[model samples]
Structures are given as structure tokens and as C-alpha cells.
Target: MNTHLLMIEDDHRLAQMVAEYLGHNGLQVAHQADGTSGLAQLQSPDTGSLPDLVILDLMLPDMDGLEVCRRIRALPGPAAQVPVLMLTAKGDPMDRIIGLELGADDYLPKPFEPRELLARIRAILRRRGDGGTPAAGQSLRFGSLEIDRDARTVTVGGQVADLTSYQFDLLVTLAERAGRVLTRDQIMEAVRGRELEAFDRSIDVHMGRIRAAIEADPKSPKRILTVRGVGYVFAKQQE
Candidate 1:
């Protein structure tokens, strides 16, 4: 099945270029000029099934991309959980940080090479297992926390935790090697199937977001601990 991707961008030219490029590479692209229409389409039941992924632009003609991301996360059902890849023209690290915190699966800065964009898209979709087969009955449990690899979900104390697709995988990577201290490079390398792609401190940001979802107290985390000068390690013993 060709992956369906929704591009919510105001730049018609760029959208066209991306659509053509991705279309050639097995993705069906749908264009939306603003966040309002994008959100409306996502919320509308008549739109049929949700897209596999959303390519959201940070600057929109109608609403801020951050607001759109917030609303997307608030939407009902699977629509709220669709992976988002944010696009920004600005060269600010804060934008990437905020976007990830707001539930974006990934981000690509503007003036980016199309090949790199394709690679990133492939990486995200691969991590999400776009159309790949799922491993049966594979789930990791530590105390009340359950990481369901098949369902691509995390549940804490019987309640579902809100984690982005990428974050979920990151957690699994750590959980699989619980009690081991992995440096930023090693962690990224472990997850780098078809190129995990990393920016400085990106993993840290994702870790913070993951902690907020799974940890009882994000400020003083227990599930995933920071080793100060080292990287991070998932606690083998959990409550």
C-alpha cells in the first residue's frame, strides 16, 4: 500500500515539489494550505481513514503550527496519534524542542536536501512499521508499566500513556537494555535502523518527553535515569 501523507504547508511550490518527489518514491501526498483545514479534515469522519503521517509546517496562514500540533494531539481516536513531521524555515533549536514536546515525531529544517527529507521520512515510517508485520505478543512489563511492541503503545498503571511514535521506540530501545548506561551516540546507534538521524540533544528532548508520559515524577525521574555526565539508563527495578 502506498503510504498516505498529509502536507499542511502554505507554500504551494514547495508542497508541489515534495509531493512529486515523495510520490515517485511510493507516497501519496495530500496538500493542505493551512492548519485549520488540516485539522478540520483530520476531525471529519467523512474524510475516511486518517493518513499514515502528517507533514506540518511551523508557519501557517491560519494558525500557528504549534497550535495545530496541540489540537492534533487533542483529536479523538487514531487521528490524534498520527505521527507528525514538522517543517520550519527558522534555524532555532527551541522550535524543534517545542515541536517534539508537543508530540511531533520528527522535524526537518527548511532548505533541507530532498534526499535527506526522504531519508528522514523513511526512517520515521520505518520506525512506525508503516506496512510491516508486527511481532506477535511482544510486550515489556516493568511493574505497572507495559510497553506493547505490537500495538506500539505504552500503558502506565493500566492507563495509556501519550508518547509519540519515535519516543515509544526510544523507550523500547532502553527497556530492552535496561540497567545499561548508553551514551547519546550509542543510544542513537542502537535505534539507527536505516539511519536513526540525530541532532545535538535531540535524544535528550525526546527523553524528557518520554519521562513526562511514563515517569511518575518527570522532574525526578525513576523509570529512565540521567547519569549526569553520561547518557541515560532505564531502571531495571520499577514501581
Candidate 2:
């Protein structure tokens, strides 16, 4: 079955081009020109089925894309958890950070190549379990931290950690290779199936979010340690 994708973009020409391009790549692309209609489509009962992913443009006639993403995350059940990849024409770093903070799975700046978009889409979907079924009994325990790959859940100190889908996968990537220092490039490649760009801080932001969820003190994280001028490492032994 083809992956379903919803594109909430106001630019008609861009939307059409992206839809057609993604369609040719085995994705079922649905488009809405405004945030209002897009939100309605997501909540509609007769929509048949929810999309596996959302490609959202930051600029919209009705509402800001960040607001749309927040509303989506506030939706009921599975709808709230739908992965979002933000599109922004703005060059502001804050916009990207805000999008990710609001649970967007990824982001791409304007003027990006269609192939990069496809790569990002595939990477997000792969992390969301579209690639293949996770191995059974694939659970990891680091003292108080527990990760259940099959269930896609994580708990710290007997408490469930509220993590976005991307953050959860990032944690798993680190945990699976505990004690090894993974550079930002390696981490992004492993988690997103893409290389890190210079001055890109998305990984750092996501790491902060993940630490906040699992660490007893995010100010001084124990589970994920950062190496100066290097990258991050998951502690081999955790208390």
C-alpha cells in the first residue's frame, strides 16, 4: 500500500508540483490550500483514513503553520500523533526550532530539491514504522530508563516519558549504541537518513527535548552526555 500524505500548503503551483512528484514516488498526496480546510480534513469522519504524514507550509492564509501543528497535536487519539514535516520559506532559526518543539517530525527550508524532500519523507516514515516491523522482544533497560521497541514506548524512573515520535527514535538510536560517541552527522544520518548541514541545530534541540523527558535533571543529563566539540553519547551505565 502506498503511504498517505497530506500537504497543507497555500501555494497552488508548489502544492500541485509536490503532489505530482510525491505521487509518482508511490505516495498518495492530498492537498488543502488553507489551514482551516486542512484541519477540517484531518478531523472529518468520512476522510476514509488518516494520513501517515503531513507536509505543512509555515505561511497560511487562515493561521500560522505552527498553530496548525499545535492543533494537530491536540487532536484526539492517533490524529494527534500524526508526523508533521514543516516547510518554511523563512530563514529564521527560531521558526524551525518552534516547529520541532511543537512536535513536527522534520523541517525543510524553501528552495529545497524534490529529492531531498523525498528523502526526508522516507526517513520520517521509516522512523514511524513504515520501513519494517520492529524486532520482537527488543527492549532496552538502562537502570531506571526503559525502552520497548515493539510497543514504541519509553519510561524513565517508572514514569512514562512524553516524547514526540522523532525524539523517541533519537533516543533509541543512542541507546542501541550506548557508550559510543556518535557525531551529529552520524546521529542525523541514522535517525533521519540524511546528512547534517553546517550550523544546523535541529539535532541539538531534539536532544534537549528528549533529555527533558527522560533525565532526572535535564540541566545535567546523565543518560545522554554531550562531548565538547564532538557529538553525544549514551551512557553505558546509568543509575
Candidate 3:
């Protein structure tokens, strides 16, 4: 079945172009010109059966895209399961960081190539398992840390850890590939479904936060180790 997509862009020309292109690429596209209407479409009775992804533009007639993103992230159940890729003219690192921090899965600067846009869309959908099977029933245990894919929860040292969607995915990706030295670019591609920003430190900041939550001693972490001049690695536990 073709994956459904909801595209919220105020520009009629851009919306029509994107919708047509994505439709030709085998996606079922639903277009909305405003955030309010987009939210309505997302909340409609048929929403449960609607889009698997949302492409949201930052400039909206009624509300900011960040607010729309927060509302979507705050939604409960299957609605919240839908991943969003933010589109904006602003290329500021702070803007991108804020979008991610607000639960946007990824961001694309305007004046981007349509090919790049397609790549981003495919990457997001692929990571979200539209292109592959999801690990739905698996559980992983390393030392006192336990990851439950079924419940979408993580427990560390017998204590439940509150993690954002991105953080949980990042931890899972790292834990599943323990002992592998994943560079920042690799890690960003793995978890965020896009290329890393040249000067972004959001990944490092998130890693630190995850360590503080899961590691016995965040100052001297054992599970997630930093490799000098490289990136981060999940250290395999020694039995």
C-alpha cells in the first residue's frame, strides 16, 4: 500500500508542485494551505486512516509551524506516531535545533532541490519503517538497562527513563549496534534521517542528556563512550 502524506504549505504553487511530484513517486498526498486546516484534517474522523507523514512549512497563515509541530507531537496514540519533516526558509542552526527540540523529526531549508526533498522524505519514511519491517516484539538488555520495543519504553538500572522520541530512537540505534564507532554524521543519518548540519552540536548535547539519564556516573560515562576526533560509541558490557 502506498504511504499517505499530509503536506501543509501555504504557497499554492509549491504545494501543488510537491503534491504532484510526491504523488508520482507513489505517495498519497493530502495538501492543506494553513496550519489550522491542517490540524483539522489531522484530527478528522478519517485521520486515523490518513497520512503516515507530515511535511509542514514554517510560514502559516494562522499559526507558527513550531506551534503546529508541538501540537502534533502532543497528540495521543496513533496521531502522534506520524513523523513530521519541517520546511522553512530559515537555515539558522538555532532554528533547526529548536524544531528538533520541539519534536520535528527533521528540517529542510527552502530553495532546496526537489531531489533532495524526495531523498529526505524517503529517508524519513524508511527510518519510520515504511520501507522496511519494524522490530515490534524485540527487547534488549545490557547490564541494568532494558529496552522494550513493544512498549516503546526504556528502563535503566531498574528505573524508567523519560526520553523524547528522538532520544529513544538514538539510544536504541546505538544499543543495537553496540561497540561500533559511529561518527556524528553516521549517527545523525541513522537517527535523524538527514545529513548532519556542518556546525550543529545538538547531537552532542542530546548524547550528554541521554548519558545523564542512563549512566551511573554521567561525568565518567561507561555505556556511551566518546571517541576523540571521532564520534560516540555504545560500549559493550563485559561479562
Candidate 4:
């Protein structure tokens, strides 16, 4: 299958540049100069065709980028799962946060080099692939907590939890293989896109954070167990 991408930006020159650059990089690019048309195209199965990725501009003449993002996320099923990379002139941290909160996988400020944009886009897609959407008829439950892999979401007693990308991936990985021991290296490979360095403490930090969030008692974790001189395991009853 071809790698399909939709670029939505009102700036004709910018859109052309991006489309050309991405195309040169071997992706089938679809361009739209306005938000309304872009939204309509995305919704239109005949024309939109559900691209693998979306490059969106936050400022549109017809609508706010945030609104566009919300509408896209509201899309049912597979359409809603398409990764979005928000390319905009807005540089405020709040704006970036809002973009991610609205379902954007990544945000790149304008004036970015085409190469950098490509790299960012690649990383976002790689992360999504690492998570692997939940399989049909397969749901994991732990107490009141639940993980719907299909939706890439976790709920606690029916209430959705706000988790960072890393956290979500970690939880899903561990829960998917409950009761199995996973070394730090294995866990890092499963979620993080790259290899772990010998001195890297990133996994430890992530584990601590996850324990704090999911464990009823962080001091004595029940769900995530540590194996001395080995690795970690996910289990309600200690093995």
C-alpha cells in the first residue's frame, strides 16, 4: 500500500513546498488550501480516502485548527485513529499543548526545514506503530481499571484517565502480557522507538511514574512487580 498524506494549509506556497518535499520523500501527498474544504475532503470517502497521516495548519480562514482537530477526532472508528501532525505559526507552549490535547500526534512550528518536518512526522508514525491498536474482542481489565487497545485509552472505573504518550504505551505493553517478566531492556524496546543506553534511567523514571498513577500503594506496588537482579512483571497476585 502507498503511504498517503493530506496536507491542509491555506498558504498556497507553503502547502506546495510541503507537498512537494513529502512527495519527494516517497509519500503520496494530497493538498487542500482551506480548512472547510480540507475537512470536507477528509470526510468524503470518495476524495479524502483516509490518508495515513495529516499535516494541518492551526490557523485557517474558515475555522480554528483546534476545532478542525476536534472534528477529526470525533470521526468514528478508523478515521479517528489517523495520526495528525500540526504545522503552524503559533509558537506558544499553550497552543502546542492544546494541539496535543485535541489529538494531534505532534506539532511543528512554521519556518521549520522540510527535512526536520519529515523527521518529526516519521517519529510520530513510528510511535503509533509501536503501540499497535487493540485487537478485536480482546480487552484487558484490572480491578476498576480497563484498557481498550482499539481506542488506545485507559479507564478507571468508567472514568477516562489522562496519560502522556509514554505512560499510555507502557501501561498497554505491560497489561497486554500480564504475569510475564519483562526486563528494563525489553520494556524499553517495546515502547520506546530506540535502543536503551547502559546508563539510561529513563525506564526507571517511567516505571516510577506509572506505579504512582496505577498502583493503589506506590510504596508497595501490586500491579507492577520488581524482580531483583532481573526485571519486572505485571500481576495482581505476586508470583
Candidate 5:
């Protein structure tokens, strides 16, 4: 199946250009000119199936892109877990930071090449999967915690753990290499990201979120421990 993408962009010309370009490249593109319409589309998929990914604009006609992102993450069911690739027109690094903290999987600054955008879209989708660490249907167990690659889910004691798709893959990267400390660069490389920015602390942000989801106490994470000046390591032994 061609990857499906919903783009919420206000610029008519840009939206048309993108839709046409992506459509020709083996993708299915759905366009919404404003945040309200885009959100409504997500809330009620005309095709009765959620798009695989959302391409959100930072600046929207009715709401801030971040607000739209916040709403998307707040959505219930699988829709809430859909990966988001945010588009920003600003040069401020904080915008990217806030988006990530709010559950955005990736961000691309405006004035970007269509090729780069397509590349990013592909990367985000690929990184959300097992990504070489675990095969489909493989499950990793640590006490009450379970990482199921086939389902792309993480659960602790049978209770579903809420995680963005990117976060799920990040967890898989660490779990598959339990007990070994990985630097930020190594983690990013392993996850096959479009790679995090130089010295970007976004990895820390993702780790904090992941800890909150699976750890009994996120404040004192036992499953994933920080290596003070090094990076992080997934614990091999868990209670």
C-alpha cells in the first residue's frame, strides 16, 4: 500500500505543489488548508481509515501548529499514535523542541526541498518500525514490561503504554541492546532517523517521555538509566 499522508497547510500553492509531488512518488496525499479542517479530517476520516502520518504546518489559519499537534496527540486510539512530521517557518530552535515535547515525531524547517521532505517522511515511517533491532512478531520482555515489535506497542503489566511511534522505535533500539551504554549519536544512528541535529537534546526529551510511559516511577527510571556524561543504557535485568 502506498503510504498515506495528511498535510495541513495554509499556503494553497505550496499545498498543491506538495500534494502533486508526493502523489507522483507512490504516496497518497490528502490536503487540508487550515488547522480546523485538517483536524476534522483526522477526527473523521472520509475513507474510514486514519492516514499513516500527518504533515502539520507550524502556522495555521485557525490554530497554532503546536496546538494542532497537541490536539492530535490528545486524540484517542491509534489516531493519537500516528506519527507527526511538523513543518516550521521559524528559525527558533525552541519551536522544534516544544513540538517534540508535545509528541511530534520529527520537524522540517520551511524552504525545504521536496526531496528532503519526501526523504524525511520516508525516514519517519521507517524509524517507527522495528528498524533492524527486532523482527516482526518479536517481543522483548523485562519483568512486567513488554515491547512487541509486530504490534509496535509497549506494555507494562498488561496495561497499554502510550507512546508515539518514534518513541516506540527508540525504546526498541535501547531494549535490543540492553546493558550497553549508547551515546546520543549512536542512538540516533541506530534508530535510522533522519538523524537528530548536532548536540540536539531532543533525545533526552524522548527518553523522559518514554520513561514516563513504562517506568513505574518516571522520576527514578529503572528500565532506562542515564549514564551521566555518556548517554543511556537499557537495563538488562528488570523487576
Candidate 6:
């Protein structure tokens, strides 16, 4: 079955181009010009047919794309868990960081190459489907924290962690290499299959989000620790 995608973009010409391009690449695209209607489409009566992924543009006529992304994550059932890739023309790093903090699986700046967009979409889908490069049937446990590799689920103290697809992979990557410090570059390479960009803080933002979900106190994290002037390491033992 072809992957289904919902694009919430206000630019009609751009939307049409993306939809057609993605369509030719084995995706079924549904485009909505406004956030309100796009959200309604996500809440359609046929719950079984929700889009596999959502490509949301930051500029919308009805509402901000960040809000739309939040609403999508707030949706009930499987719809809330749908992967989202944010698109924006903003050059500010904080905008991208905010989008990721709100549960977006990926972010792409506007005026981007359609090929790069396609690659990002494929990477998100691949991670969501296979849990990245981890071995099948693998599981990790530290104190009350449990990670089910094949199932791609994380729970701390018996409570499920609300982690986006990317965050989950990042956690898994760290946990699997517990007790060993990994630089941001290494982490990005392992989780994203790409080198880290210069001064890119996306990984740090994701770590903060993950810590908030699993740590008893995100202010002073216990599971994932920072190494000054280095990188981060997942504690081999959790208290």
C-alpha cells in the first residue's frame, strides 16, 4: 500500500507541485489550504484511514502551523500519533526548535529541494516503521525505565512516555549505548543517518523533550546526563 500524506499548506502552487511530486513517488497526497479544514480531515469519521504522515506549512490563513501541529498531537486515538513534518520559510533556529518541542517528527525550511523533502519524509517513515537501526526483538531496562525495541515503546515507572518518533529513536540510541558518552555528531549520525550541522541544537532540543517525558525532574536529569565540553551519556543505572 502506498503511504498516505496530508499536506496543510496555504500556497496553492507550491502545494500542487509537492502533491504531484510526492504522488509520482508512491505517496497518496491530500492537500488542504488551511489549518482548520486540514485538521477536520484528520478527524474524519473513518478513523482507520488517517494519513500515515502530515506535512504542515507554518504559514496558514486560519491559524499558526505550530498550533495545528499541537492540535494534531492532541487528537485522540491513533490520529494523535501520526508523524508530522513541519515546513516553514523561517530562518530562525528557535522556530524549528519550537516545532520539534511540540511533537513534530521532522522540520524542513522552505525553498527546499523537493528531493531533500522526500528524503526527510522517507527517513521519518523508516524510523516510525522500523525503529531505525536497532536489532529486532531487542529490549533495554534500567531501574523502572523499560524500552521495547521492536515495539518502539518506552515507559518510565510504568507510565508511558509521550515521545515523538524522533525522540524515541534518540532515546533508544542513547539507552542502547548506556555508560558510553556520545557526541552530538555521533548521536545525530546514529539516529538520523546524517552528520550534525554546524551549531545545530536540534539534538539538544530533542534531548530536553525526552528528559521531560522520562525524568522525574527534567531540570536535573538522571537518566541522560551531560558531559561538560563533550556530549551526553545515558546512565547505566537509574535511581
Clashes of each: 0, 0, 0, 1, 0, 0
lDDT of each residue in 152-192, candidate 6, tens digit only: 88998888899988899899889989999999999999978
Comparing candidate 5 with candidate 6, which one achieves the higher lDDT? 6
Tens digit per residue, CA lDDT, model 1, 72-131 = 999988899889999976568898888888999888889788887888888888888874
Tens digits of per-residue lDDT, candidate 3, 90-142, equal 55667666777777776788877878888888877766666675576889889
Could you tell me how far off, in angstroms, the CA of residue 172 lies in candidate 3 after the best superposition?
Answer: 2.7
In candidate 2, stretches whose alpha carbon ends up further than 4 angstroms from where it belongs are 45-48
Model 6 pairs whose backbones collide: none
Please write out the lDDT profile of model 4 over residues 1-239, one tens digit for every residue: 46788888888888888888988988778888877887777787654488878899998888888888888878765677677888766446566666766667667778889998888777766666632444686677888778776666777768876554546777888888888998888887776555655554446555676676667787999888899877788895532
Query: Over all chains combined, what TM-score does candidate 1 have?
Result: 0.94
Candidate 1 vs candidate 5, TM-score winner? 1
Instruction: For candidate 5, write residues 1-239 as lDDT tens digits.
Output: 56789999989899899999999998888899888988888887444568888999999979999999999999866678888999986577789889998999988888899998998888887776512344656799999999888878788999999888788888988999999999988898777544557757878989999999999899999999999999999999999
Best prediction by TM-score: 6
Q: All candidates: CA RMSD in angstroms? A: 1.8, 1.8, 3.5, 6.8, 2.1, 1.5
Candidate 1, residue 125: CA error in Å?
Answer: 1.1
User: Which candidate would rank higher by TM-score, 1 or 3?
Assistant: 1
Winner on TM-score (3 vs 4): 3
Compute each candidate's TM-score over C-alphas.
0.94, 0.93, 0.80, 0.63, 0.93, 0.96
lDDT of each prediction vs. the true structure? 0.88, 0.90, 0.81, 0.75, 0.87, 0.90
Worst 10 residues of 6 by lDDT: 129-138
Q: In model 4, which regions exceed 4 Å deviation? A: 46-48, 130-141, 144-239
